[model samples]
Each structure stands twice: as C-alpha cells, then as structure tokens.
Target chain A: DAGVTQSPTHLIKTRGQQVTLRCSPISGHKSVSWYQQVLGQGPQFIFQYYEKEERGRGNFPDRFSARQFPNYSSELNVNALLLGDSALYLCASSSPVYGGETEAFFGQGTRLTVV
Target chain B: EDKVVQSPLSLVVHEGDTVTLNCSYEVTNFRSLLWYKQEKKAPTFLFMLTSSGIEKKSGRLSSILDKKELFSILNITATQTGDSAVYLCAVNNAGNMLTFGGGTRLMVKP
Candidate 1:
C-alpha cells in the first residue's frame, strides 16, 4: 500500500501571502495530522483530524488551520505568512485503533519558503 | 506541558561501531513512544514502544521503553553510513497528538 502522499512538494510564497498544502492519507486510514519542521529541528505538531473532525490541535497560532475531508484527505492553510513561516510541512496518517497505538506514516513533506 | 527530550544532540562514529540513543519524556497521559529516522525530507518510522522490559528489534536496530523512568533507548549495532540521519523521539499523549524532541543528529563515517 502507498504511504501518505502530499501535493506541491515545493512552494515559494511572499510575506503576507496565503498558502495551502494538501495531503492524502493512506487507504483505510481515517486520521491525518499536520506538522511543521524547521531546519535542524524536529517536527512540531499543528493539527490532527480523524473522521473529518478536528481531534487535536497543537501550539500553532490562528494563522494555521486544517480540515479533513470524508475521504480522509486533509489540507493545511496558513494565512498572512511571515518569513518565519518557512519550513517543511509534513503530513502523516494513522489508524487510531486500540487506543492510538497505531504507527503513523509520513509523507515526503512540502517545503515552503516565504521571502 | 508535555515534552520529549533527546540526549547528546549530535554524535559522530565510524562504521561498524555501536551507538545508543536516549529519549526521555514527560507527558500528562503517556500513550506510546516512537522512534523515527529522518534522512532528508521524510521521517521513516522505526519503532513504537509502549511496554517496558520487552525490547523491540529489527535487523541491527533495537529499542526498549521504560515507563517507570519515563525514558527509552534506541540501539543500533554495527552502524553503517546509511544509518546516518536525524533520530527523532516523539511521545503520543492521551490527546492523540505527538510531541517530538529536538532530535539527535547522527553522523557515521566510513
């Protein structure tokens, strides 16, 4: 089976611009999560959606938002991007069964550069 | 606040050498601890440990979790250059969200 897949592997945006990154979860998976990874740092959680509902959210600001579709796909949107917003956005999918013990598979991630 | 911390922020070793990576976490409601290997863009899953004592092993890599001390260790035996990457430790809390550590950058020289 294919792993999690993300779209627009690379993106370049300007400050104050808005950007959207997309993710398609693995087949039969109902949970999709978004994370941002800065250079030389581990990924920071942004949002997690299961069954088309917001299940969990991280410490990100209002500028960051995400939603999941019925197909279990997800989109992460960042508004009024700042230079500090530049980072690699990752998407991971998991089957949260048996009390969230399932392993999550991650995508290659979309590299966003804001100038 | 839930947090995960990794030790020895970075390490350098030659091939065939063995290395042990450490991860300690403090979470409100701990569910599991995971290890991932990141090379360039993506992080590949290595192990998900929830129970203590029983070690999980794959090939030359192995990991064990200790819920009592809230720490885990990843052991890689006979390391190779291909084993070089950023090793990340993340904790799955009760909320089903993953909290990642700063990661340990490993460099294996031939």
Candidate 2:
C-alpha cells in the first residue's frame, strides 16, 4: 500500500496569487489533515476532513480552505498568498481505529514558495 | 490556545553518543502525545503515547509521557548518522487536531 501522496513536489507563486495543493491519502484511510511547516519550525495544523465532513480547523485565516472528495483525496486552497505563505504544505492521513489509536502518517509535502 | 514547546532547538552529537529531547504541552482535554522523525519534507511517525509512565521503544529510540506534568521525553541511544533529523513532538486534543512543537534538530556526526 502506498503512503499518503501529494502532488507538485514543488511550487512557486507570486504574492496575492492563489494556489491549490492536492493530497491522496493511503488506501482505506478516511481522515485527511493539512498542515503548514515553515523553515526550521514544526508543522501547524490547518484543516482536517473525515468521511467527507469538516472535522477540525486551525487558527488559520479564512484565506485558507480545504475539502475532501468522496474518494478521500484532499485539496488545500490558499488565496491571496503572501511571502509568509511560502512553506512546506503537508498532508497526513489516518484511520479512526478503535481502542484509541491516532497516529497520523504524513506525506513528503509540497514545497510552496511564494515570491 | 493549545501550545507545544520543545527544548534544545538543535543538538550535535558524535555517532554512538546518546541524546534526549524534551516536549511540554498545554492543551484542552489532551488525548495523546506523538513523536516523529523528519529527514526532509515528511515526518515519519515514531510513537504515540497516551498513558503515563509506560515507555514506548523501538530499536534505540524510546519515549515516555507524563500526563500529570504534561510533558514527554524521547531518548535515542547508540545514535547513528541515520538518526540525524528534526524530531517533532505533537499532541492530540479533544478537538481531534494535532498541534506540533517547533521540533528539535539532531545532527549525528560520523
């Protein structure tokens, strides 16, 4: 089985532009979450979708939005991108296991550089 | 707001040495704590600790969580160059979201 997969290993965008990053979760996983990781920092959660429903959201501005398709793939859209938006966008997927298991496996992430 | 802080933002050690990373968190209705090793873009899962005192070990890496103190420690013994990476600490709260710390960068020199 393949691990979580992300598209466009690297991306470059101009300030004020918009961009969309995509992710395909591992097979049989229903929960997909997105995160932003700046240089030298840990990833910050942005949004999570479980079973095609918005499950959780971080403190990111409304400019950032995401959705999960019926196939369990996810897309993260960022509008009016700023230089600060340049970071590695990560997508993690996990299954809601019984007995309290919640280890989210991550993808290689898309490197976004907004100039 | 939920927060996670990691100590010793970066460390350098010779091969065969040992290292310990620390993580402390403050959150609402904490559920579990996790550790990950990030070599480049992706962070691979290391351990997910929910209960206190019980240590999770794999190879030379082991981690233990203390619920009462709201902190956790990760120990890497007999470190090898392969262990060089950013170690990330994260926590899951009732919100069903994982909040991460800034991470500790480990460099094992040969």
Candidate 3:
C-alpha cells in the first residue's frame, strides 16, 4: 500500500497571501492530522480530522484551518500568512480503532516559505 | 498547557559509542509518549510507551517511559552513522493531540 502523500513539496508565497496544502492519507486510514515544523524544532500540532469531522485542534490561530474530504484526504489552509508561517507542514495519517492511542504514519511534508 | 522538553538539545558521539536522550513532559491528562526519528524530510515512528518500566526495543534503539516521573529516555547503543538524525519526543494527551519536544540532534561521526 502507498504511504501518506502530500502535495507541492515546496511552496513560496508573499506575505499576506493565502496558501493551501493537500494531503492524501494512506489507504484504509481514517484519521489525518496536520503539524508545522519550524527549522531547528520539532513539529507542532495544528489540527486533526477523522471521518470527515474535526476531531481536534491545536493552539494555532484562526488563520490556520483544515478539513477532511469524504475520501479521507485532508487540506490545510492558511489565510494571510506571516513570515512565522514558513515551515514544513506535515500530514500524518493513522487508523485508530478506539479513537486514539494508535501510531501515525507521516508524509514527506510541504515546505512553505513566506517571502 | 501541555509541554514537552528534551535535554542536551544536541549531541555528538563517535561511532560505537552509546547515547541517551531525555524527554520530560507536563501534560494534564497524559496518555502515552512517542519517539520519532527525523532524518531530513519526514519523521519515522520509533517507539511508543504508555505503561511505565516496560522497555520498548528496536535493534540498537530502545526507550522507556516513567509515568510517575513524567519523563522518558531513549537509548542508542553502539550507534552507527546511519543513526545520525534528530530524535523527537512527543506527549500524546487525552485529546489525541501530540505535543512534541524541541528534539535532540544526534551526530554520529565515523
């Protein structure tokens, strides 16, 4: 089976612009989560969607939002991006039978650079 | 607020030497802890620990969690150059959200 896949391996955008990153989860996986990893730091959770519903969200600002499609694929949207938003946005997918406690498989991630 | 902190932010060790990475977390409704190895692009899952005292092992890498102490340690024995990467520790809380540490950069020189 194919692992999780993310689009636009690298993206460049100007300040105040909007951008959207896409993620295709592994087949049979129902959970998709978004994380932002700044240079020299680990990833920070942004949001999680399971079964086409918003399961969880992090402390990120309202500018950051995400949604899961019926096919279980996910898209993370950022509006009016700031320089601080430049980072590697990773998408992780997992199959949690009990709603949690399961392991996750990550995609290569989308590198966003705000100019 | 949930937080995960890793010690010795970075380490340099010669091949065949051993290294230990530490992670401490303060999460309200702690559930489990996880370790991931990030080479350059993606992070691959290494181990997950929920119950204390039980050690999870994979080849030269092993990890143990101490729920009572709110910390976890990952040990790499006889490290190889292939083991060079950023070791990340994350705390998974009841919300199913993972709070990740800053990560420990391991440089194994041949």
Top candidate, metric DockQ: 2
Considering just the first chain, candidate 2 attains a TM-score of: 0.97
Fnat values, one per model, are 0.68, 0.84, 0.68
Candidate 3 runs further than 4 Å off: A98-100
Model 1 C-alpha lDDT per residue in residues B49-97, reported as the tens digit of each score: 8899989999999999999999999999999999999999999985447
Instruction: List candidate 2 stretches off by more than 4 Å.
Output: none
- Which 10-residue span in candidate 3 chain B carries the lowest summed lDDT? B90-99
Q: Evaluated with lDDT, which candidate comes out highest?
A: 2
Question: If scored against the real structure, what TM-score would every candidate get?
Answer: 0.98, 0.98, 0.97
Error of 2 at B75 (Å): 0.5
Q: Model 1 segments beyond 4 Å from truth?
A: none
lDDT of 3 by residue, A36-64 (tens): 99999989999999899998999899999
Q: What is the lDDT of candidate 2?
A: 0.94
Span of 10 residues, lowest total lDDT, candidate 1 chain B: B90-99
Model 2 per-residue lDDT tens digits across residues A4-101: 99998999999999999999999998999999999988999999999999999988999999999999999999999999999999999988778654
The docking quality of candidate 1, as DockQ, is: 0.73
